[model samples]
Target: MAEAYPWQEALWQQLAGRTQHAHAYLLHGPQGIGKRALAERLMALLLCQRPKGLEACGECKSCLLLAAGSHPDNYVLEPEDTDKPIKVDQVRDLVSFIVQTAQLGGRKVVLIEPVEAMNINAANALLKSLEEPSGDTVLLLVSHQPSRLLPTIKSRCLQQACPLPGFEQSLAWLGKALPDSDEQERLELLTLAAGSPLAAVSLQAQGVREQRALVVDGVKKLLKQQSSPSQLAEAWSAVPLLLLFDWFCDWSNLVLRYQLTQDEEGLGLADMRKVVQYLAQKSSQGKVLEIQDWILVQRQKVLAKANLNRVLLLESLLVSWAMLTAQR
Candidate 1:
């Protein structure tokens, strides 16, 4: 498969050793943590008729077909807009590919990315194919959140979690790609990114820096218990819900680091240690985990246009969050 992220190399070799011969697998992890890259690489290695296990022999006929995206035995299922979910038709089409005999007379490989997008009907349809994958056919499903997938779908595959590389590793990797990047800025984004290199890069480009300042300042005012909770929520009404989650995680980790290691440098400086620690220690029980679970529920409700009142939603978040912080 693709060159794995640093944290994933060991897992790749493990899979190479124990799972290369399996018929199905689920490579699941946080978004943008390189699961797709690893999946493609694994596919290449498996389809290679003469793999050294060191690497796929890239010049082989199978490799050539894969490179051209014309491999008869290799297929990738995804949720295109026209196909909001991976359809039964898509699953049925696989029968032909699995039965038509491989173009190279080799193994058949199919990958489904974000397998969670498969709606109930589509999921059940794919379940049919999973029931009886043909000889030497390999199925790989890539899901960032397997919780979004049906447990039945997960049961058919051998699941492996792709670990995210921590901040230090992400910084070093992103450094090579951003030679002129500001050290403080890079670390801030790196911490914010939670081990995803692309997320680090995307944050820099997305003006998340200023956005975070707004969020941090807003959260601090709410914690100070100065501004009316409703007013604070009104100000933050437009911030992405994910921003709240990201802030919570990063702030908690930062405060934990300060308490456990006393590393108040760079991004640590961006943190108001006492403020962070207070908020972190508080909402943790009241809202940290609960809000996280709620966010997913809210995301669906909001996205579905299920009568979400932005005012009440944001106000509830701030009020609960502030009340908890007050206990600290």
Candidate 2:
């Protein structure tokens, strides 16, 4: 039984009150905002034989089956591999499931997470199912990038935006989730997660704090010319490529911010304030923007699943940063 976050309470209440739900719902929001949790909770609520308020009755057969991951009418579709495309065949199977009668004789639910991962063919295949879902069915499409979906698909479902919680809300949640973390550490983690509390929790669980420090230290060394790009890239090879690029992109933006404003107010890299200040003083705005643009290009390449040599990519990025240290 998935529980809703504090920020999701209002939405949960609203959804609970609705006796008649749309055939499909598109829960679109930024990544790490708990959309999937909300969707799963809703699925449980819909599937519960004896529902109580917005929650599922634990003793119900449906609830037990769902908990055991054998719910006959509840379907979840995702990419077969991480960061890969969901193919058309998966949607074809979902179509077959949709046509079948509900085993529990209650509402059927289908959940597709990060639906943007579906390629053009898969997206097209899903359009027909999304348009005309059979029986008492609810299709929940959870997307971090809804803009990538076809326009016709968007028009077929009710759009729900799950927004990031405010800083104070996030801080309170983090304090409870990570009680061992001090105030400063909580703030840093929350900032790194871009105000997403769940993402902050995940970062802590993955030991991102230690990895981040190493990456930051490596960047400092690179800027000081103490290490070469190839060496730093090899040292940080164990780190996830996307996460490393995201941090680098953030740092690049901070450098640009400092160059433009000559102040470090609200910078994401608060722990590296001195480094940001130093780079701001030494690097020209033009140079910083060039690096920022390059980072954006690299990020797009990664998102597009371009065939890239990981070491070479990181090496080139580091070399670019090192060169910027010499900018007048």
Best candidate according to TM-score: 2
Report the lDDT tens digits of candidate 1 across residue range 1-328.
3665787889878877764466779899887688888899888988887887657888888888888898878999887663255666776776566656666777889988878777677788777567578777988899977887888888988888988887788888889767878788788777677668877887777788787787778777777766777887677766665566556555555554544554546235445666766554454443455655555566666433356577787787667666654543
What's the residue-level lDDT of 114 in candidate 1?
A: 76
In order, candidate lDDTs are 0.73, 0.87
Error of 2 at 277 (Å): 1.4
Candidate 1, backbone clash total: 3
Q: Lowest-scoring 10 consecutive residues by lDDT in candidate 1? A: 262-271
Task: Tell me the alpha-carbon RMSD of every candidate.
Answer: 4.7, 1.8
Worst 10 residues of 2 by lDDT: 262-271
